[model samples]
Target: MKFKSLLAKPFAAYIYSKIQKEMMHAVADQEAILQNQIKTGCKTVFGRGHRLDDVHTYEEYKQAVPLRDYEQLKPYIEKIKQGKHNILWKGQPLYFAKTSGTTSGIKYIPISKDSVNNHIDTARNALLCYMAETGKHDFADGKMIFLSGSPTLERIGGIPTGRLSGIVNHHVPRYLRTNQLPSIETNCIEDWETKLDQIVAETIGQNMTLISGIPPWVQMYFDRLQAKGGKKIRELFPDFSVLVHGGVNFEPYRPSLMDSIGGAVDTIETYPASEGFIAFQDSREHEGLLLNTNSGIFFEFVPAEEVFDENPTRLSLKEVKTGVNYALILSSNAGLWAYNIGDTVKFVSTEPYRLVVTGRVKHFISAFGEHVIAEEVEQSLMSVAGAEGLRVTEFTVAPRIQVAEGLPHHEWFVEFEEAPQDLSSFSLQVDRQLRKRNIYYDDLLRGNILAPLKLRVVRKNGFIDYMKSVGKLGGQNKVPRLSNDRLIAEELMRFLQ
Candidate 1:
């Protein structure tokens, strides 16, 4: 009834319809693009290297096209880097966004002119969703700050290319770009410390009213802001209205962020990845993040009932329904077709196509044969922190294999705002909760295959410092929360020692 009231307003229904219509157009366009590529791929396999990147027919593509990855696309990407417009697209690209995935190495993902157009469209849809929910569309009246990777467009090996953050800043409607202060200065790739300092300096007098980015780096920035002590955020930005975040779960890091903001600001969670813009916060309840099905992306779902494999069944947009957990697979205009990026999600319902992120398919710990997921770790930390009246600064779980000739056990490294009353008891409670949630862990417990869980109290910035030492402090890189027992045990030995 409440949702009906919210959707009944003429303005709300109009906006929603517009988004739906635009999304349909994107889907249609993407299908056409893929059809063309399939044709070109067919031609290439039949001894036609010169004719590649040209238009292809459906039959030509369907006959010979193979699933591609970053490695397979390397030579074509190099041609693009050489300023060869015809290699990847018919026109020159606006910029190349350097995206890193699953490793420390960087990827030069060319941002085609049409993809830039897609960014504008995506930005508009985000705004429209905001307006439909709150009935407010006046973004110009207030300042909005996007906490992005250093805005400096750094070169990979030799070519000067922007990261996704820098490319987005470079393409921001031209007007908003002028008023904004970039998190990174131009041509500076010195290091993280220098980069953070320059970013902090840029914020000194800016009246930024809205902020967006990964919550961890945003929290780090706010910590630095608090240390400065002279400028309170509320005083500096009186019109501050919202916080937008994406890329990871927010619950474990919420308390410190809430305290910094001083009050409840409008919160928006987005699912923007290198592949496509998947979803955004659509309602006040935070019940489900709405999918942007109109974007030139066709969605597929792999049910959680089975392990994802070479031949897992996929559900199309028409077939997905409510209350089923599924891994997401996407086909998009940017060249990924039915490619699985390994994020797991579940549909809250199908008609409106709302879904919630369940976890990462690849980011699980199977140490000592107990499969532990990121969602389990996040939920456990959030629940425990809330119940104990404790504010967690940052925490990570590392599964340890017993090296003393006994059963392996799980260990958690936690950093809190203050110490707890009973460290050992608190540790036991968290372990029990974790064991209850994870079926694999419960089985191990019953079999007496695992020892009791252990806890380690870490200093603030402990993980941050460790990441920095490994040269993976930020910028699309995240510390792994779960790993196989071998990797976890190795990491734990280093940290514990």
Candidate 2:
């Protein structure tokens, strides 16, 4: 083992033990966080406006502060942007994480001094937990590359602002700096294709051990490497052992990624957002991510079905039940209160609060009154593809409500790395699996209200081309799995094979 790996092993063990202890006392830690947030809120302008001073319990907090999305909270954020102090949190935010929004053009999410530590620490602990559990710390001996946005910042209201990943890039520890790949100048390139080429040139010959990024982008990198060197990634970088992925479901992309690597590696899934780092995969044996309850955030879950109601049922960590789908809501030290982050999740284990991200609240197909979520489609397609030993590059689903002669149906745009022998039969199996998982879809098909989903084969690099056209090619952007309308479907039709 390298000297760095030997030094990190004991530290990883200590951090893992601390994390295990925190998981054991998750409920108590959550309660303490909630109380602390409430106390801090009393001194903010938002708290005064919402009558937070009189709120003594969870029920009172709920009644005093209504759930708010980005649009609803924009007014207060605007004041903060104008250099107001104690508007949201105790003082001005340390940074604004700028992200593209669907309805709203651009969103500036605040990261306060108290909340930023959670983002950095949670990520470190996740890797440390893996090292402690598996005794595999040799990856630290070689280079580690996190494919992220540029570590560039501009001032907004005198506060540093940039992408969340970019902001975090500035805080990477001194020890890891020498081991990090793709020099700062290369990362600063705005265009993804240009940056991608630069990254390939810089790291292709290096001893890359750990690779991290969203799966699709990482897949793109792998393709570039293979094209350049004419060798599998495993052959090019024999020490490559761990892949850290987030932002989307990994199952659909796993077959293709594994094929490119030519072997197996430890993969870790993380639940991170501009608001906070919510969860991370803690064990290789576990099925779900271990919730970050001891962090500077308090979590709540509203039943998915009732999310649009005037007042939805909000359940705390102690009250959530396994297998029920719920929309994630959070109140954090960042001064976001009862904020709905638009993600739907299901608890797989309530004992230690392990949950799986189901889908986004707005990213679903309900055009035909049959609410089809991302989870159902991902599971159905992956199940069928895995059974057939086929490889899928990427895919998305959108409703097709108009037809010339027959009933309308869901249209699946699939890009295949290895096409199945019988495409029609594969589509049928996928539809069957989805029907079994979702009774509403089955009922719609039985009632003749909708036709079976049709698969449209897409040309290679179709999704990538579409994203590039829209100027959202990389850095935390992902193709939505499903949509209620045909906006994306119409645009995607141009790429059909």
Candidate 3:
């Protein structure tokens, strides 16, 4: 038995048992965490201003701190950029993870020493939870490759700046880094096109037991391997047994990936954001992701149905009901207080606190009173494709505004790995499934508020080409699954044309 496995096995088992207990008593856990976060931040300017010192209970904390987004926090973040200390958190920040903005250029999210340690711990424990649930430790014995962003960080206000993946790269423990693929020189390459080529060259001959990355890029890596030598990935690396991916729903990519790998492998999904590492799939016996209740982040939820309200009611883990979509809000050791991350989730189970990501707050379309989300869109596509024997590669949907001549409708730009025999029928099938799922959409269709969901069969490699144009081709970056407006759709049309 390897030393790493020996250390990892017992650690994983303890976490697995602890998680089950924590989730069973989640209300107390959440309440204690909320108070602890407030107490910890009492020394910061934000805390003093919000009377964090007096906030002793979850209700009191809620009354003191108003929920905020990146825009609302921009002012404090700016002060921090000017070398401010004890602003949001209790100390000076050493790094800032640069994230793509929701509506604009860039966002600099502060990352402190305390939060970085929390990030590493939560990330490791997620995988450990899986190991504890299922006794599979063979993959840990050999090399592992994770497609991450370039580790060449730039300095912003004397603070290190780069993608969240880059931040995690620096902190991966010495034991694992020794067997990690892709040399430091290769990771430093800024351009993804050139970087991927280098990664393939470095990893193709390695005895890789595990591969980790966002699904599309991993597929791209597999594609390059096949194009180079017509052999399936399993043939090139026989030891490959695990593929861990996250950042997007996996169903759409499953068939393509399974085909590429040429066999069934253990797959794990994780939920890590620029804001914080959130959750991971814990067991093969169950499907939904286990929430990290003890991961230095206190989570709150607002019913997605109430997200647009001026004063939405905030609910803790104890109060959240299963099957209702709720927008995730967090207060973390990272110095964010009552921050809305904009992602929506529905609880699949409350006992072990397993949930499914529903969609983003900004990614939904509510025009014509029909609120359609990414989950609805993706599920509709998956159903139609499965029935029609088709494989879709990448897709995005946006509303086509009403004109003088006709009614507005949802337009889908889909790039397919296997195109349906009749494109028109496929589009209709997708439309039908969506209508079944979304009654508002169905009502609009019946009432003529929407003409029909439009579908355009995009050219091969169109999504990759579009992502390259935007300079976000790989590493935690993915094409926006849905947009409320025609900005992305129109741009994609222009680029593909």
Candidate 4:
């Protein structure tokens, strides 16, 4: 492949035309941003102003800057609230993408022109790579369908700042852009119901091809599409090329989604955040997604083992190798310098820098000191389901310590698409699998630890509906994979009880 790429370099250049130059320019621009951040970041820290010495290299960038979260920058954010550009940017931010405030309620993530440009470039690179591989720029001469969030623009006083989706949606090139299906860009409004109505109306008789969004939301969208009286959307739009999803793991909702789609529609995983579109699926056949290093940021990784309880062990772009788990860190033009985004990934390959996301370091349960990761839990559940031939609808795991004057145990509340005949055995199987994978669970089995695994079956789709009713639909609003305290667990227990 390397030899072919080298030999085909001249021809590739001829074929790509200015694309190669644009890619190179993108890299140069990203590097310049990193350089400038290292300098300004120091000035921002000291309030003494920045100099050349303060900037340069990862070490200097680290030393000259103090780590800050969104809360720390609240004063500047307040300025934006008052319609002023105070700290982060030279002017008022283009607009804010309304993201769920994980621990803080609802907060708006400020989006700048540079950050938006980076996201655009990432999308272009992904599209170009696909075009180069397939040799067919257009898929079956049909349009793509993106099941996205409310694309209504944020107008403080009705001036049209543009919807988060529309910001990029409107910028799609006139040449490549299609007129086939409804886009979230123009369709997103205040009401989700009205948006869904328009989406259904627009794609009812059209040749819609691609579908993209968070998995659970996509499943709900498919349900709506099917509910609109279609046996198969394939029958409606035969050319549908693929389903693209990201923001959260799709494993939990895969069964229902796959069943709704009838089969796999060439699934593509994307790792995009308000920070930037960081990585994406390289091809149809590959398991590992390609990292976009040449996008608007310089990538760094901290060994996953170092991600919890201590300061992280950082790695440069040149130091990352295969098979090791690392927490992702980024230094981008959008004022995030060496920012730890809390996502953990495993290196699948090094040459082109491909990785498989393992789980979030913070998103785990250690109630019985089992230290169960989200990936491990997902894999174990899938394995158990495959073994039992059971179809699951929705499920959630809560760390519980059964203290009834007895030893404590971890409990999982599951909702299956079909109820099993031997519920006890199925529950036992899930418990045993956890015991095998988690040392703490094993200790509990041996009467060493205080807790063992327990399972409770719930009505179908109960958990999902509850999450939705609470407005925890997508984009940072998720039923947590693990909840240490009983806050979420207690709330969920309302329906279970």
lDDT, residue 339, model 4 = 61
In the range 1-497, model 1's lDDT, one tens digit per residue, is 23323433555557667866654454454456556544433333222453444435433332333334456566777766665545544444456677765542566765655556565566545655676778654444455667666556665435457667656765566545544554335214446566666666677567766777788778877777766645555665666777788877877778788788676677778887766678877666557777876555556667854544544565656667787667787655554445566688887855466787877776777766676777778777678778999988666666676558677787777778786889888887787788888888889888998876777776667667766767776565566566554453344344431
Over 125-206, each residue of candidate 2 has an lDDT whose tens digit, in order, gives 8899999999999999999999999889999999999999999999899999999988999988889999999999999999
Taking all chains together, the TM-score of candidate 4 against the true structure is 0.84
In candidate 3, position 211 carries an lDDT of: 91
Clashing pairs in 3: none
lDDT per residue as tens, model 3, 92-131: 7767999988664689888888788767887677678778
Clashing pairs in 4: 153-163, 408-451
The sequence of per-residue lDDT tens digits that candidate 4 reaches over residues 1-497 is: 23333444444344345444444444454456577655544444222333435456667665655444456555556666776542554455666665555564555556666677766766655544555655533452456666555555666522235435556665655644664357644455545556666777777677766777777667767777888956666665677766778777887777778887776666667787776678877565566877766655777778876665345566776678888778888866565555666678888866556788888767777776667777777777778897877777666677666566666766677777787788778777777777677776687669756545667777666776577667665323456676666666666676662
Give the distance in Å from residue 382's predicted Cα in candidate 3 to where it truly belongs: 0.4
Better of 1 and 2 by lDDT: 2
Segments in model 1 whose C-alpha atoms lie over 4 Å from true places: 1-17, 20-95, 137-139, 154-160, 183-190, 230-232, 304-308, 485-497
**Model 2: residues >4 Å from true position, as ranges?**
none
> Which candidate achieves the best lDDT against the true structure?
2
Query: By summed lDDT, which 10 consecutive residues of candidate 1 come out lowest?
Result: 38-47
The predicted structure with the larger TM-score, 2 or 3, is 2
**Winner on lDDT (2 vs 4):** 2
List candidate 3 stretches off by more than 4 Å. 495-497
lDDT of 2 at 81: 88
Task: Provide TM-scores for the models.
Answer: 0.82, 0.99, 0.97, 0.84
